[model samples]
Target: MRLFIAEKPSLGRAIAEVLPKPLKKGEGFVTAANGDTVSWCIGHLLELQAPEAYNPAFKKWSHEHLPIIPEKWLLTPKRNTSKQLGVLRSLVKQASSLVHAGDPDREGQLLVDELINFLGVKGDKKAAVQRCLINDLNPAAVSQAVANLRRNQDFIPLSTSALARSRADWLYGINLTRAYTLQGQQVGYKGVLSVGRVQTPVLGLVVRRDLAIAAFVSHPFYEVWAQLATATGERFKAKWQPSAACQPYLDEQGRNLSRALADNVARRISGQTGTVSRLQREHKKQSAALPYSLSTLQIDASKAFGLSAQQTLDICQELYEKYQLITYPRSDCRFLPTEHHSQAATVVAAIEHNLGQLNGQAIATLPLNLQQKSRAWNDTKVSAHHAIIPTLKRHSGLSKAQGQVYGLVSRNYLIQFMAPYEFASTEVEVSIAAGSFIAKAIEPKVEGWKQLFPKRSAKAGDPAEDADQLLPNLTKGQLLSSLQADLLEKATSAPKPYSDATLLAAMTGIGAHVSDPAVRKILKDTDGLGTEATRAGIIELLFKRGFLLRQGKSIVATDTGRIFITALPDVATTPDMTAQWEAQLTAIAEGRGQYQALMDPLTEQLQAMTLASRSVVPTQLKGLGTAKVFGKKKRARKKTSA
Candidate 1:
């Protein structure tokens, strides 16, 4: 009998519908026409063994055992999932062939590989193990995936990557958690001082930002504005002393000078004719952004809909697992290769039909000039699944939030296949009284994919007015007159606290000040700090650990969190550590980097940190129950004398 194992129950059931089924059973298991038994795991049925499992004495927490490092890692069935493991174990024992149908990502590959290894299934001496690589859980994709099942050896690297990540996380989490907890207890603290590879760095970001905000000092600034009348007597506002340095003059605690200068600058330009000293015009095309990756979707949702990262992820997961209307929700890739474009129309049609108000007309109306050809959109770049796209399933029975998220995913998918937005820009530079001033306008020739979000406003910090403005016919060197002028006071603002949207962007290493193209590209490729699947969870873990608190949309670090980050070495707070680790892991995936190259350095660092911590004298404890200590001989003598 052939046994099929799926990543989750919903996907397993979906796969069963397309199989040549003989019978359907409860939960996620089914029997095929050839008597093949298929079942699914609820994510992972087994996990790494706990610290206590390494040694019986390790079960009890003690300060003596400062760091608990397991010599040999072990895997054990999860307590609540042992029954499911039992069923799978029995199936594995009896089966003549096995199909690994877990999710197509690294985690899925590792789960199946771990299960097989744990069950002692291997190497010409056991049932054949095949891997099913399905991008979508629908019938067609499932059928194709099964028909093209690859041998298990082909996926060894992916499995290795997954195992490496898990083990690294374990080594860091277990050792650091024990060390901190013991230290805290010795200091009379009761809570667990938790840390992890990703969470610690993420928390450090929040703490750093909080510190910056707390340390910021605001200053006053000023701007001079004038109401200018055109030759036709139409009124428009213009600013005096349009140099960037003008804003800083008023911010230097010279209110008297600032007011006097503002008045003088306004007077000097009141009757000046704004000249067009230079004329620059260009035509540019802006293509639609690539399709949604999990990270991108979360960012857009948080910015556009005011949803939190966790909220966006939850919505996407529901759409994928429950509604079955989208592809996998944890993918990092954003572009579909040329081969996947043919199926794009079908998915779009399905979404348009099911989503009321969006129809075939809307899909057809999208601009034709845009095409998906980004670096992110490669077939080989996709591992277990392609980018998140609408499934063949018609959208139905969705909650309001689901519909909103689905709309975002679906619209982005169709928009990518559309043409780029075309526009012509006009810049007029005028010289008057030996001073040069410039005026610019843009006229949109075609709306392109921007029509997808027609009602959407410009993003925050963008000019309130549209970039595309039709300027009246005017020649350079022709001048007009002015009517009024005024001065405006502005304050120098501190950096804004991180909202979920900006925080996600920051975690990905796309800082507001990072402008170097090569550096930006590296950050993008590396995903800044953590994978999309883990980033939100890392933030949530910080909150749960009292490292951060949500003040409205802003993430503020707690005092304890700040102190913890301050106490840690510089390497622990920076993304460079994660980036360096990721680089080695990627090399390992491609057979260019050795696992020891990464693990050895981490092990050394861990040992160094442990020793450093042990050498430090713990803080004195206060308010604890008082007790007296005596030499063992004196205590024994006193007891005998008594």
Candidate 2:
């Protein structure tokens, strides 16, 4: 029997239905009419053995066994997934050949590859092992992909990379987490200190933000604005442009810091008529946005539905797995495959059909241009999986949350088929008494791709391009009769706290925070701290560990979180280490790097860091749970006594 393994049961069933052959149903697998077997896994059947798995003594937490590095790694069947693992193991023994029909990403490769290793089946030969890679779950795509299968041996490097990442995480997380936790417990702290390769650095980011915001001191400043009306009773506003000589009242960024200077300028410009020194108009174009990646979709969903990162991913997973309305929801790739663009028409038709079924009035008025190929489609730019888009399969009875997430993916994909939004913008320089002020306006003539989104009216003098630009008919050298000026007082604020949306952005683009240039460049090429598929889970883990608290939409590091980060060394808490590891993992996946090259050094580092924890007295820790550990925290008096 030729066996095929899918990442999930729904996927296995979908492939079986596409072949048009009656499949024999079994306990945990299915058999096709041709006698070929198709089995499924509920994601990973096995997980890395925990610290205690290596030895019995390690089970108890103590500083004596600090930095416990596994001499030989092992895998244990997950409690709930043992039945499926057994079923697949039995089938693999009977089958002479195997086909890996798992998802295309590295995680999927690891899922099936590790299972193969555990089953003790030889899948080294071309005929003995094969791979099925397909992005869309539709019948046609699946059939075509299966028809041209490659040897599964070719994906060994991908699996190797995944293994390296998993072990490295275990090495760091298990040892270092124990180190800090034991140190904290010794000092009489009662809470568990949780840490990880990615989550620790991410927590550091929130703590840093809180520190910055807390340290910020407000300083008042002034900005001058002129309210003016044209000759035809049309009104507009501009600002007094500051020069380099305004240094005394300006900061490092050249932002004005003087109220008196702004007031003096306002006085000079009030009621002073100015001439339009220069007038320029140019047509601007806004190309269609690329389709949604997991992060981008998370951001949009968070903004549109007020959903957290984890909530968005859960809903999207439901849409992809349960409803089959969208392709592979775990994808981080934003670019669509050029060769696959031929299926664009089918996806559009499916979306239109689904919308028609549900009376989707949101996009009923917008027409989808099937032939318009935007920059989103590219042959080389596509990754393991393409953007999350509506598949060629239409699903009914989707939940409200699923429908909303589906709609976002659908509209983002649909917009790429439309023309660029075009607008003619006008900028005029007004010569006032104090200085030259500028007036700008944008008039959108072509609502091309903008038709998909609700039109936003721009406030007058607002710099945003889409805002309403109600401009009067004026030319160069035009005279303005009446003018009024006033100085507005404002203060510079510290960086805003990290919201779920901003926190994800930070994780994806954390190279901005790392000081080392080489590490920063590597982080730029390699995806940030965690893979797109796992970032949501990482955030959820932080919440479960009580390291992060949700304050409305913002993600605030808890008191325990701040302490944990401050307790760890910079080598562990900074993004530089994880980013460098991610880069090496990418190399390992491509067959250019060795696993031991990375792992050996990491083991030594974790052991060294653990040994260093001997001197750590948790109660004396400057940052971690200080108030609680010291018993010095107090509540403010209800009434003030002088």
Scored by lDDT, model 2 comes in at: 0.80
The numbered model that scores best in lDDT is 2
Error of model 1, residue 394, in angstroms: 1.8
Q: Ten consecutive residues with minimal summed lDDT in candidate 2?
A: 633-642
**Which candidate ranks first by TM-score, i.e. highest?**
2
> lDDT tens string, model 2, 299-321?
88887788888889889777777
How high is each candidate's TM-score? 0.86, 0.91
Taking the tens digit of each residue's C-alpha lDDT, what string does model 1 give over 183-299? 656777546666677788777777878888889987655565555455887544443434555545533443323766666666777777776556678898987777888889998
